[model samples]
Target: MRRIVGADAVCALIAGALGYLVRFGPAGTDGQHVSLGVALALPLVWVAAMLVARSYEERFLWVGADEFRRVFFASALLLATVGTVSWAFKLDVARGFVVLALPLATLLTLGQRYAQRQWLHRRRRHGLFRQTTLLVGHRAGVESLHQQLEREAYHGYRVVGCALPGGRDVAAQFDGLPVLGDLDEVVDIVRGFEVDTVAVLPSPELDGPALRRLGWDLEDTRAELLLAPAVTEVAGPRVRIRPVAGLPLLHMERPELTGVRRLTKGAFDRTSAALGILFLAPVLLGIALAVKVTSHGPVFFRQERVGRDGRTFSMLKFRSMVVGADRMVDDLAEESDGNGVLFKKKDDPRVTRVGKVLRRYSLDELPQLINVVRGDMSLVGPRPPLQGEVERYGYDMHRRFLVKPGLTGLWQVSGRSDLSWDDSVRIDVRYVENWSLTFDFMILWKTAGAVLRGSGAY
Candidate 1:
């Protein structure tokens, strides 16, 4: 926390000096003296605003978008305060100074925070600076929560032990973590284990009153209590707590499918797709030439894929397999290396020599930008499934069709062909349930690294 404060202070000072230098040049003018005074005072005011906004709170630090949101709020608050004071006092505050200083400070501070977060994540990956956690719930819920925390180690949770509904009789150990005690002994267990976090998963025994009492019991301890609700895969923006008649209710907004947001998404997809195609014209042509020269078939491959609402579209790709490769599916079915729903062979006989190179760097999928331009796909969405694959879909999997299939999506960025069928479906459905422009942008950003690594491509 002190490191963050110090870094923020340095960023603010740098931004203030930079703004003053840019707005008022090095000259001994009347405005120069006032500008220097303002520049000197900016860092103190900026840090104060951050304190007022609670940007330094431990819960908001080291993870999630809340920290960035608070930083933005603090910057806005500072601007609003300055604007009001200038207007009320009729002081000659330079608009250029305020404009240059506050925005620069915010950007610098955000950059510093990002750098620090990256450093912290690197340390956490090696099992450093993590919170010792104790799980309290039924075995099933505890196991589920434990797995999730393990998967996302950067969140800084290290599950040391658990307290189940029943003590040792239920089970001596769970997934290798010692079963500390029963729910009744959680407070003692937390203190004894020096737990930094106590994660209480949904359980019948821990009702409202019991949970409240547990909270009161842990008040003197250093452990922070976290409740894991049954609801899963919902993003923060869609969920809100509403206190109605002294009872807190979780309110979830409906997914944005048909509205101005959808319209904006469509426009962005087409426009960006068009620009991408234009920018990558040379690379596309080069790949087409290579495919044509190395293979006995056409340079382009078009396959029927299920899109939004189960509508089928001809998804385009640079040919990465031999001609009539589809006819050999049954012959290679037994040798398939794919998750049951998707057929992927790491070393398939159908893939041409040039095709391997193309698939390795995901060059084969470049033509899907045209699909985006045609409104048959999005730049970021669920994977486009084959007609046969759609036929085998369960009812829950159909939720993925709520939006157009994407050129790249959670499946693509996560592991592409290497992901299990269930994982792929879950990721796609989760994305559909929490669709937002910001989420799309984040997926798009991750896509570049995924493509470069080429870890999961067949």
Candidate 2:
């Protein structure tokens, strides 16, 4: 917490000083209006706003996007407070000073926090900051929870052992978490391992009163109680806990697919796509020229893809395959190394020499900006699926069409062509169910790293 606060303060101070210089050009007027006093106070005010916003809270800092979102809101609040004060007092504050300081502080502070998070991730990977957890459940449920904890180490849980119901499986084991004892000896296991958390998964033997009694028994110790729901892959934002009568019920809000939220997303997609095309004109043209010069086919390839509402659109791409490549699909069907529904061959003979390089780095997808602009696709959503792939879609698979397809999406950033059909479906459906402008931005940010690595791209 101290480190995070210090970094945030330092970044705020730097932004204030830089903004001061940009506004006043290093004037030696210390006591004058719009002077050093104002600059110094800006950092203090920003820090206070961050503190009030609880940006440095321990639970928020270690995981997820909420911490950074809080920081951003705090910065906005600081700016709003500054603006109000300046207006109310009719102070001669330069607009440029506030304008520059807010964004600079946000950028620098976000960068610093990202650096800290990476350091924390490295430490956590080495088992630092992890809780030695004792899980209580049936053998199957215990193992399920154990697998999840091991899979997501960032959650800070390390299963030390398991306690099965009724001493039945006391000598058994699930994965590597040995059945240290039964439910009756759960507290004993917690004491023995010096466990910091006792995670409870649903089992027939443990009912409501039994779990409450367990919690009461652990109250004398430092160990925390956690309930592991069987539900998986649901994001934090969607889950809401409500105390109805004496029962605590969990409700998941439906994904917002209509109304203003949907409209805002559409606006963002088209505007960003248009700006992207303008900014990358030189690179786009160069790629087009390269494709035309190095391949026998046209510079662009337009393929039919399923988009929102199961509508078909001609998704554009920089041609990276031989002319009449579609004709070769049947012949190479047996050679497919792709996920079941998608036809992907890592070393397809149809990919031209220039095509290999283009596909590897996803340079071929740049032309999809046109699709984005035309409203058939988004900048970030599901992977634009082929028409034939949609033909294999089961009943529930149609949920992916709730949003427009994307040039780069959860599927693209995750593993692209290397993803199994199930993996691809999971991520895309997750994206559809949890769509937000902030979440979209996060995916776009991760997309750069995925493209650079080129690990999964064909």
lDDT of 1 by residue, 158-227 (tens): 9999998778888889987899999999999988989999999988999999999999999999999999
Where is the poorest 10-residue window by lDDT in model 1?
Answer: 26-35
TM-score for each predicted model, relative to the true structure: 0.95, 0.84
Task: Score residue 1 of candidate 2 by CA lDDT.
Answer: 82
Off by over 4 Å in 1: 90-92
Which candidate's TM-score is highest?
A: 1
Give the residue spans of candidate 2 off by over 4 A.
Answer: 19-27, 30-48, 76-103, 122-129, 138-151, 166-171, 175-177, 327-336, 391-395
Inter-residue clash pairs, candidate 2: none
- If candidate 2 were superposed on the true structure by all CA atoms, what would the RMSD be? 3.6
lDDT, residue 276, model 1: 97
